[model samples]
Target: MPVAFRLPLQVFYEREARHPRQPFLVQPIGGGAVQTLTWGDVGHQARCAAHWLRARELPQGSHIALISKNCAHWIIADLAIWMAGHVSVPLYPNLTADSVTHVLQHSEAVLVFIGKLDDWPTMAPGVPAGVPTISLPLCPAGDFDYRWADLQGCSPIQDDPLPPASALATIIYTSGTTGLPKGVMHSFGALGFAATHGTELFGLGEGDRLLSYLPLCHVAERMFVEMASIYTGQTVYFAESLDTFLTDLRRARPTALFGVPRIWTKFQMGVYARIPGKRLDRLLRLPFIGKRVGHKVLAGLGLDALRIALSGAAPVPEALLRWYQRLGLDVLEVYGMTENCGYSHVCRPGQQKIGWIGLPCPGVEVRIDQAGEVQVRSGATMLGYFKDAQRTAEVLTEDGFLRTGDKGEQDADGRLRLTGRLKEIFKTSKGKYVAPAPIENRLAEHARIEQVCVVGDGLTAPMGLCVLSTVGQPEARHALQDSLERWLEQVNAALDKHERLRQLVVVKDTWAVENGFLTPTLKIKRNVIESTYGPQFQVWSERTEVILWQD
Candidate 1:
């Protein structure tokens, strides 16, 4: 059967009935207490939760929101909502009350499911009036109301006819780096198709395991972590936290893992932190020492067992991808967005190439528009943005192709190499177009360069604001600056006259979500960086050398 016609909750329940004792999910809550749930338990719990939702006297297809960290119950609530024929909306845990209010008001969600409730007070004001909320780990201390367990005691609902495959199943809000968050509506067919292709493309099966650490709200995690489990009946493990991510990976020994470029980059840094790149490369030049060291580093990262490690959600520096390749992990770069049900293109196992997002996935058609913007027609194209038809028309073409808003080209071998966002291209003072992503990707490819923002708006040539190399020692910082200058010279020589970087600013700190420089998925907010540092670039540009920020 085509996956687009399959209901995931139905299949998951069948797996539970077939193998009640088999582990479906393994999560460590805290203090040596583990939360283990088999498919049977999940099936039973979701049915009861479905029954409770049905009894709520709300209209069918009503919206229910989930706000939480990565946890097992977060997923359970999601499936339960779908079982009840409702739309599930997930919110990032780090969003402020104002932003949360906007989503709640925008979605008109009837109820909320909050997991790992730490700071509920800050989130309380965001809940729209008349909406009831249920907390997963901890119940709301005040009037917010309800606990996850409250619905568990309800009667288990026998399956009624499941919703039609074309019915709206989920509404994922885009992170909105460029504009206000739009509720991206996806049908069961769209999501299921992505899972089907993803499972087959990655060779996922019953034996495979996956660690879920990235925000479940994100389409990448939702597709790779959640839907992969449904398609292949693989065990899905939720990470306790970043500190426990490695331990969880080792414990699960995941065969399939998905991470953003920043995470992969950090893993590369961790490997090199113990063994300097020069010594390691020299050792790798030999036969036995190189093999031994490579195995050790991969094993330490718990990635030695990974068959398919994916990087997506933002452009990854080619250097990081190649570094992992040297260590024997075939890290494939994927290009996708929430609108496409989290998949559009992927690099197959043996066909990886750095600096390219790779070939289109099975069942997806990709073509470059005359303006160089990539367009896609696929089974997974979103139905439309919720209640925003005009906005939907803006992205979806009249001929059924979805405008990707990304400028890219297909290589001779059909691999899609993304250049930058069509909207993000800036015009320099010399009236030349500057594509920052390609430049940023190249500059960030340097071993000593961590994060970079290519800035040249209204300027003669683009200059870079870079997060300094994390591995540099106090004395090495100065020397690293010299090395970066030389690296830039090489990069500049390869660029067109207008594309060359005029100067570089070495930022002392890493751009992090906590610092408001990067989004939760680790994509740099170009507007924020440009606005924050644009004034300083002129002063620093006068000095031709790398301007190191001391404080």
Candidate 2:
């Protein structure tokens, strides 16, 4: 279908008005206290906020950055900006002060809406000189410069029309898993098309409810919440906090859900913890017991009622997907980058191939370039990187396809399987090339392992450095270690002799963004991991068995 000419959110409000009393968002503030908003409330809040934004009289294309977690106010603010004819720039809540400043300066944003303050005051200096920053209207502790309630109270702007679909909609910064994050500019038409196409694939329509916990600042959530909701008129419930996530899940009982691979891994772990993996696996192989256990597992996870549960942002362990399938939750693994307005290829419902990100959505054309890199061009592709024309030109081919930077292969069935990052492959000392991803993924398949980083850029053989050994299941640690070693042997056997893992380094505790071992996208920074644990690598390589890194 052609991208709709009208701003998608405007169409959304019309549907909300038609079903004003229907529950739109169910937010749990805490302590079993729930704040529910009907369709009318969402429409009213958005309208009031839009009126306040218009009163500011900013330039037609003024950029406004919203720094916040997922919340009702975030959506209200985003829709208001578009309704009032401006660009919405979303900043990840946990961004460093340096990154915050870089993004604000790069986008030339005039105003900022900060929701919750974790690193804000320190990050404020990054806002650039002369940029007037306003608080995100959230009532958090510490002095706040502005309140969202005040914005709602501002004089109403006579209901003005929304901009056309061709107008600029948003600038989403890349998670910066590699180099400095670049802002990708997307038009309303492209975003709307992706959403509409996704809606068709999922068979979503009015009355569908979506639990919104993923960061609204990211392209995935923008597509799932802003665009998909607009196209399907689905009720979106904003999660209050991580503590209240499970309760919120039961309350909303969402028909559709989206989560990253990490979250899915956690869910898989939770199920195995409840029913021991061995028992569950044995039961799944049985006839009637298999079906009964699967149903029970699905209901326990509150996914029995779900139409679809999607995982994205990283490659999912095929084992985890199989486990969920055993429990009757058909979790679909999707693939797309920030350069594409999030739905490039999605696993077709009931036609899933575990570990493969299924076929491309309708109207999307994907092909492997000569270098084996996946490149795609579609109505959903971003126009270009914001203010980085030279870099944008490098990624976009003369024919208009966007270079995805990921190596892939398309099977006969059109299922796309990711190989590894083109940049992440390194040559070992023995002159054989190694890709750390498959090795790391294979190691992480062990439930005891939480994170893995395969290093040895110039070593005779690559080394697998992992940071996990059963986070609370100490009794299973020894068995877990043995299982992990066996798994590594199987993986190494598959690789060329020189590319095999010489030894495994099981580092205790977790390596996280806060700890500086991993990037914000949860990808391990190989250089950081190697530099911090260089000595451990030397010792582990000399040992025949898997050696645990002791502090």
Lowest-sum lDDT 10-residue window in model 1: 1-10
How does model 1 score by TM-score?
0.96
Clash totals in order: 0, 3
- The pairs that clash in candidate 1 are none
Question: What does candidate 1's lDDT look like per residue over 1-551, in tens digits?
Answer: 23344666656766877888888888787765678898878778878898889899789899999998878788788888988889999998888788899998899898998886556788778887778888775333656477767888898898743677788898999987866789999988888778777778876788889998888898889988888897788998877767777788788888888999888888877777888888877776677777777777888988778888888887888767767766767788888889998788999988877777789988888889889999998889999998899999999999888998899998899999988989889998889998888888888888876788888878877888888656753436667767877888888989998899887777766678866788878888887887778777777766656445535
Residue-level lDDT of model 2, residues 368-446, one tens digit each, is: 9788999988888888999989999999999989898899999998999998888889888778888778778776788
TM-score of each: 0.96, 0.93
Model 2, global lDDT:
0.78
What lDDT would candidate 1 get against the real structure?
0.82
- Highest TM-score model number: 1
